[model samples]
Target: MTMRNCTLFYSFANYGLNKKGRRTGKATLIHSLRLKEQLELKQKYLNKSHELMRTKNEINVEWDSSLSHANLLDTPCGMVPLDTFTQAQRQQLLLDVVEPPLLSTVNTSDFGKIKSRAKYKLSDWIKNDSFCDAGIAFIKEILASEDVVNVQHSIYQFNLFDMKRKSQRTEQLVSYINAHNTLIDKPKTLNFTNFQEVLFKIPIVNGIGTDIVSGKEMMQTMKEFIVHFYPDYPIKLMLLHDDERLAHENTGAHVHAFISGQNALTGKYDLRIAQIKKVNEFLFKRDGMSATLFSETGRLNYEQAGDVAKHMQEMFYEFVNEHLFHPKNINAAFHPESVRKSEKRKQMRKEAKLAKRDRPFNYHTRLLEDVDSLEIKAKKLDDKISQREKVVDDLESKAAYLSENCETLIIKRDALEQQCIKQEAAFQQNQRRHSKKIRLEQEVDERLSTKRKEEKKLDESILLKQQKHTELDSAIAEKQSILDRLSVMATQALYPIQKMLEHMNNRLILKGRAGAAEFMQHIIKAFSADLPTELRKTLIKITNNTGDTELENALTRKDSQINDSFDM
Candidate 1:
């Protein structure tokens, strides 16, 4: 729009604040504050000649210092980092930007007291308990930390609204129109040039726009997401302008709808800074829950504010939860910010456990297992060796016994040879003794035969002598008897004995030896000697003892034999 159009847009906003009872028909307003809008206003109102300077100033602010540190690998929401401009940075990009009042904060308990009012009847009140909770949560989340806020910027690039991509911006406007789809009511009159112009001015947050988001509608959509999805944060909308090039193309004329962190109970950045101002002063005062909360955008009346806060809070938390508020980003969502801490303690404990595991043992586990196996095998081998040793001992005993038996056999053989030698010597001695006895017996038999022959011859000679001697003795004794008869009769016996002697001598000489006389006496003695020793001795002794007659006879025979030998 031209300069005159921008001034005219602001003029309608002042009129609504002054007239209490005047009913103003809905018209777009450029009221709410954006830090970017201030920079635009600074260029237009304050510096007319430094056009290049303003552009440079705006560009310098828009160029994010954060981009220098950002790694391309860094994804803001989830996948791709959207080029999210800040409120200050966003407003700085537009040509004719504006600033609005800061939001209000409310204490939660005050609303319970107002419930007694009939218009504020609890039954007619929307079921926004969960929605309020979601708003509270959204507020808490943005104010959680600086890093969390950075993530929130990336969220604006989602399907809902994206100023960077013209396609997304176009899509957002189309979707918004479809959601509240109004049959464009034929105007009572269409002023061909100014039909889209205001009949009655409607006060709005910042840029001129329709209530694209309805009050009842915002509450209904918000109740489900805000109450069910996120229930702690309160929602607020700020405004921004279009790029001058794209401005006229937009029909609804709203710049940007966004959220705030300051609670409505207090005029401070309650979630961020602390202030005593009550949230009600800035809020749209009316019935239903809307009368209870703040409205940075004039589009929401009492009901609309309630609904917008609820719906926006829902969308805010959804975006925050889905993008900015990842669970890994916080230690405890339920706790106050006071409870978070550094992780050094946990790291130290883990390191201690690892050190303990690295301590050495008495031996390696694998070596122990191998040693056990070796011991078992050695025992088995020892058993086999012991059995073999026993067998060797048994064989040695048998061999010892055999050696003793062999020695005994050798001794027996030697004894047998000695016994054979003794038997042969005894046989030779017995044979010699037997042969000597036989020779002695033969000599005795020869001597006995010779003695017997000699005795027979002597006996024959003696008989002859006795016969002859008897004849001779008888003759002699007869002659002598004739003579002796005169003297004695005994003389005749002596004469026969001499004659027998002479005959015996002759016979003895022929048969015996030549010396008969001496032989006769000797023969008698020899005969006697030839007889048995005992008988011969006894006869000689008897002859000697009786010497008278026997001696005379023997003397006579001797003389006769001597004479006969001479005569022969």
Candidate 2:
């Protein structure tokens, strides 16, 4: 069997305890004691397991010197440089030195009043709580005296929003110390600004076979792992039982830890938690424990999964234009003044103009320009022809006059008559040539007129086609926009449905029910029936076409196995 990798789950909660005791501070004391007992029991079991392995010669019995009892005794549970004490000693210090002052500062009546008003005024509760004030004062006193204090075992819950307020109070308390150190020209050691609080959860998987280590030991190992990864930053880890998860199941409760110190290297706390989970999967496997909280299919039903997939696709479509070749975001990213004068931008505009010149519309424009040029040439030819005709008429009148004086000057008249005949003949030839040229020009004009008419018809047809194309494009864009909006609405509607289904699935699984498959089928059918006619058809179509036979078969097989187990 392949080992499945585990994913980490984490969530944040509001800081203080509520009036109804949902998140009571006293629960911390109970959790500490319970954890101690559980750890001792686990240690005993592990020793027995080791002995059994040794007797069977299944494992080596070599002992590491670093984990020896003497070394463990010297290891302090809190600040290592300030104190030399074991885990037990640290717990004792908290119980004896811390609890006395904490309990005395907050009497029963005052505690009652704080709890009653906590729901309405959480900030006031945090500020007025005598227990918290006492703890803060006690720490300040120790710090002022430059004495080592180990109070790691005492749990102090503060709302994340109140960190700034708490920091201010801490600074006020430490002002004396800061002044005294400054007077002596010493470096500041207690700066609250350098630290931050991080909260994360680790779920415990039950019925995964016997646990090899206790929760405390697991926490210690995880802390060491983090320290190994981030050696420069100093960190402190405190484990607390998840109140909500524990309410559901007292045994094998989920773990919540508070990490206080410098921020993670990536600056994202969730990313740091994810890294820990990824590495811890193999670590947990090696230690004979399962880290997974749910099955491979997860808690989501098929419909819920489909809804999530659809939601993701809608989100992708919505943002796709911003990232993919669209210039909107690009234009927004740059300064408008700079972009307007940019050489590359100018080149792009020029290229666009050149592209427009190559269109069919531009070709029609060139044809119109050719027709105008032809008209100009024809007008110049007509003017030259008119001047030639006037010259011919003047020569004819001169010839008539010469004939009238024929008897007075006989020889000269004969010569003039011959000249007149020759000129008349040449004029006739020139007239025929001009007439032919005029006829040819008329024909050319007719052809040009026909071409102009054809171009006009073509332009009209092109315009009509373009109008239709534009309408189609607009219709498609409008439909797409509507579809996107509907998809978003559907996703929003399905979110709560998914959550409810997930919750149901988890409950069914926990109860070891064989009817989970039936329940899911009923839910899908009911949901489909509730949809509008068109939406129902679409849903049915998608379901019929996009069926995953493998997943279905696996679910069926699992259901059958569950039934068989119940039967047995």
Q: Considering every candidate listed, which one attains the maximal lDDT?
A: 2
lDDT of 1 by residue, 1-568 (tens): 2121111111011111111201110112211222334444433322355444455333323222233221111112321212344554433422111111320112112321232232222222223333344433433343232331332242342334222444543343333232212211111111101101111111232243323322222223333333333233233322222221111122122222222222334322222111101223323322445655543433345775444433333334343333322332411122123421336534543443331112221112222333344334433433443364345335433433333232222332333233334333432443423553355346435644654554455555665555545545544444433332322212222222223333333433233235545534543443321233343343334333322244336644644565566579
- Which stretch of 10 consecutive residues in model 2 shows the poorest summed lDDT? 56-65
Compute the lDDT of residue 232 as modeled in candidate 1: 30
What residue pairs clash in candidate 2, if any at all? none
RMSD of each: 71.4, 35.8
Q: Which candidate has the highest TM-score of all?
A: 2
**TM-score result, candidate 1:** 0.15
Instruction: Please write out the lDDT profile of model 2 over residues 4-56, one tens digit for every residue.
Output: 32222222221221222212222332233232332223222234654354331
Over 4 Å off in model 1, which ranges? 1-59, 65-311, 318-326, 329-568
Quote the positional error of residue 453 for candidate 1 in Å: 99
Cα-lDDT of candidate 1: 0.30
Per-model TM values vs. the true structure: 0.15, 0.19
Residue 550 CA displacement from its true place in model 1, Å: 99
Worst 10 residues of 1 by lDDT: 191-200
